[model samples]
Target chain A: MKYSGIKVLWEGLRGNMGWKPLWRNPDPKKSYDIIIVGGGGHGLATAYYLAEKFKITNIAVVEKGWLGSGNIGRNTTIIRSNYLLPQNQPFYELSLKLWENLEQELNYNSMVSQRGVLNIFHSDNQRDAFVRRGNAMLMSGADASLLGVNDLKKMVPFLDFQNSRFPIKGGLWQPRGGTVRHDAVAWGYAKEADSRGVDIIENCEATNFLVKNGRCYGIETTKGVIKSKKVGVCVAGSSSQVMGKIGINLPIESHVLQAFVSEGLKPVIPGVITFGAGHFYVSQSNKGGLVFGGDIDGYNSYAQRGNLPVIEDVCEGGVALMPMVGRARLLRIWGGIMDMSMDGSPIIDKTNIKNLYFNGGWCYGGFKATPASGFCYAHLLATGTSHHDAKDFLFNRFEKGRLIDEKGQGNQPNLH
Target chain B: MLIDHPLLGLRDSSEFIYMGDAKLLNRPNWKSKNSKTKFIDYGYLRKNPGGVHKELWYHEQGDRSWLVVTRNTVTHEILKVELARYLKRKENAK
Candidate 1:
């Protein structure tokens, strides 16, 4: 009836030791048409898109660990397109579109429930900001509705509507945004792509790039040398280390974010709710637990075990919003490292090196953006161009001083 | 910012206040007349019980919603300002 210490159980099942990744194909022969590094959501999604959309079957998604063992399995799994900035607005909307039809598209039950998401405004200024965002969503053809306190009362009756210091002014509601099974998103793509000739080489760690005449031709993995025409780097949190092997420095900071689930209850919350005042976001799982998470561990950390401050901060938000959850008890909390960019958005484009494509920097939204990200990353790999609208998220954007700074924090996840 | 309420404890703050007449935010596509002008505010500053800031808040974004903005016990700045004008002023001065 509880999943509190599931992390330890997960490590035991996968035979994962401290600091080593699980599900890695430790003894893989490194020769394929395409070699993808890092088997997280981004990499797996890339492989799925390469096979499903581009018809490029001669691919090998080389993962150092088992699939979805990285940040893919660690996120709180809330998906929404209620961003205010223009650069992120369309891109996130595209991801929402993918989530809408993902069950039909992947032919796998991801359990993606469109339970609606709400961003509550606690101040006149916050209300004004939501107004701008709501207007932007309306203009961009997104399904957003600004809700009143009465509407919120009708939706969530137990909410402390009037008595709190920060009263509920109103909320920006996105009817289509909700949660999904995070691991299922990864396994769904892996199962589908694996069935379609994509060599999901688990336990294979790509250590170095075999560059010939200043162009990448193949990768030298820990297992053996794999010959490939083009190599796509879909590693998420460990992207910088993987790219460093190829002499590329990304402005990516590896920060750890922890997610906590409460002991199973008889489903109190019907939909996902994010605190506008804080970074806390929560959604009830089908298994009856309250899944929640907050901001990253402010500093860079390779260690997956998070610190104490964020835990306290997130728990405080939970208790303040839903006081009844205080008695439910904390079941388990786990940490995953995210390759948080200076900006909160992701980067999906070709590097300056020919044949070396990159897809990283998914800041907490990687799970929601999995399908569209992989689809676009595949298109970028095959045609050397973006599929939908990811040209702004190029690595060159950092050099050109054109950062897509979401959260308006300006390229710093710590600030966000 | 301590304000007593039946639900919110001692330190609740409010977000913004609509001193003037404003419209309540609504769902544009909803097929009901009560979609927009649905609620009215109680024209008083309460402690904004929202976790981050401590200030009085008003939902004048086409919706007459009210909030208690919990701000710092010392520097009384509304923790998260949503009003574009106030935020723009603060940001522009910087």
Candidate 2:
């Protein structure tokens, strides 16, 4: 049913019984031209774009669980294109533009909020670095502004600006970067793709691939085997394990990153804020709860829960940045496994196996890259070429030693 | 999480710094014929198993020695801990 303000009133008067399921639960078909392995945001968005733009509709998205079960629902819901490297900036900028028109395109409210993101700098060297990054963002066709100390004090007065330990000097602001309702992204894409004749098979786990002479022709699922001409696997943290079935060992390791939310309170934070001296970031949600998170758990794990040491470290950063948050009680905390790549960047390229593609190694930045990931991956699968924006996410960069180490943190996946 | 340190007894995980998969214990030889490809695999590809994992940890705040700790990735349960000095770097290493 088409939804509008009038529909709400109509449903209210008609006793609210006209609502229907968001997407149909379809059985696995015998064959599809293309099969997306994981039905998360990227998978659903790939299906959506392939039908809407590339005109390829014989597609099937197989999910092991329901929608909103993965990182799409588990992220802290922040979005930004504030990257420094040229290899990353343009791709994320494209995703940010897509996020701008996403609701109208999908006919669903994903709540894309461009409330602005602020990265406070604690030292003069960091200030210079922010200036360089802000310049790079502008050079890559994205909006950025370096704010002075006075502007920051006027903007977020709750910050501990006068602290002697790590005084907040200034900040880099991106007015077009903010948060979006993350899971709604999955639902919007799923609904639109399903409506456009793409089948989404939930609760169907892909166990193995049917590969002969290195060309993947089908997938073996729990339900049954289904043939496909092309197979693209973008299963985030599970990338290593899923592709392991085909004897492909990726340059990616899985690590758990935790996110937290506080009990609902009156509006205090205006937009997203990052503590420069520590690894903490926070933004107030639409429901008045403060959503925040810090670094990864620094180990290899598949568990969706985390230990308390990272929790205490996150709280310390929060308290150091905004003393008011120390009083707010913690409500919920969850973990998502990150496909931490060797160089701390993502890879979206065709593998050595013909007709079998890979798109993962997203680390903790997958949520923000969802839209562009789908768009570029669709372009590659449909046209058999890399999108101009995603040309640098090649699998052979390690062999060439052309590492796009954004943080320059070396080969440590957990640090990224 | 508590690490059952072989020498230090039970200690909080915060005292130790985590290094990834203990598979790194097998460092590729720089003098081999296929060392280039082997180093790429050594520096990059990993099993990243979802079940049992043997990883390395440094007692940075205590004994300052590296230890190989076998733990379940799914349950975070420590099964065993041994000093890294006692383990062979590679099966053929002298």
Candidate 3:
């Protein structure tokens, strides 16, 4: 049912009995025109756009588990397009724009909050880098502004501005960047796609690909063999494993990235604040808990748990940035598998195996790129050409020596 | 996670810096005719197995030596640890 204020009011008057399930739980069909592996945000969004934008309704999103079980639900929920590289900024900017209209388009309350995201700088060199990044964001039709020490102090007075180890200088602020209810995004897209005659089959794991004479036409799943004219794999952390079933070794590694939430407190953080000197970023959730995360556990692993050392390191960064949070008790901690690419960017291109498209290598940026990744991936699947903004995310970029290298960390997944 | 270093005994994994697959030490000759293809393999390709993996870890805070660590990616269990320089010497001897 289409949700609205009137619907809510009517439901409230009617004892809330008219509300229905967000999306239908349908059985897997024997065949589909297109099959999207993984029912995370990217997969659901891809199915949604494929039906809504590309007019391809005979699609199915196959999932191993229930929706919102991956990085889509395990992130800090912050969204921004503050990228420096030309190949990345435009694409992420489009995602930000799509995020701006996502709630209305889906008729679901995804909580797309545009409270703003501030990347604090601690040194002159870092400030210079942020200045360049902000300029790039502006050039790419994205909003960005340089905030001085005084400006940041007015917005976030609780931060430790005079830490002896790493003094706060300024920040790069994106007024349009903020957070969304991460799981709601997956649910919204899944509901919309399901409403448009797209089948969403949960508990169906793709065990292998059905390839014949260098062409893929279906997948062997836990449920049964399902046929599809085209297949798109967007399993974020399981990219390598799933693609490996087809004998395609991806230029990606799976690393466990952890996120944490603290006990609820009064609203303190104005928006998202990223620590400049280290890998820590935090924002206060609507429930008053502080949601935050840091670097990935530096190893290749598919496990969804992390060691203690990374936790200690992340706490150290939090204390260094805002000493006030040192007393806040951590409520919960969880990890998501990250598909970290060598160049710190993503890949959304077709593979040599005919009719098989791959969309992964999102690393830390996956949550923010949900909308555009799906839209462009749909464009690729429909038209058989890479979307204009996503043309540079080809698989052969590595062989051609044209790495995007967003973080300037060369060929290192963990470093990125 | 405590990594049992050969020389330094049991050390916290935090004290070491992870540098990914130990195959990185096998540098390709840049002057070779097929250097481009070899470099692509060296720079971009990796067999990130979900099971046992041999990777490089630097004891940056303790011994200042690099160690090739054989660990299970699925279980995070360390199987073996050895000085990378010794492995390099052994490869050269071969």
What are the runs in model 1 whose C-alpha is more than 4 Å off?
Answer: A1-30, B1-94
| Candidate 1 docking classification | incorrect
Error of 2 at A329 (Å): 0.6
How do the residues B64-92 of candidate 3 rate in per-residue lDDT, one tens digit apiece?
99999999988899999999999999989
**Local distance difference test, each candidate:** 0.71, 0.93, 0.93
Per-prediction TM-score, please?
0.75, 0.98, 0.97
Please provide, for model 1 over A47-126, each residue's C-alpha lDDT reduced to its tens digit, 9 standing for 90 to 100: 88888878888888887877678877888888888888787788788888888888777766788899999887778899
- Candidate 3, A168-227: lDDT as tens digits: 999999999999999999999988999999999998899999999989899999999999
Query: What is every candidate's C-alpha DockQ against the true complex, given to 2 decimals?
Result: 0.02, 0.85, 0.69
Please tell me what DockQ candidate 3 reaches. Answer: 0.69
Better of 1 and 3 by lDDT: 3
What tens-digit string does per-residue lDDT give for candidate 2 at B1-94? 8999888899999898998888888887899989999988888888888999999999999989899999999999999998887776544466
lDDT, model 3, position A107: 95
- Model 3 CA deviation exceeding 4 Å by range: B29-35
Residue-pair clashes, model 3: 0
Provide the lowest-lDDT 10-residue window in model 1 chain A.
A18-27
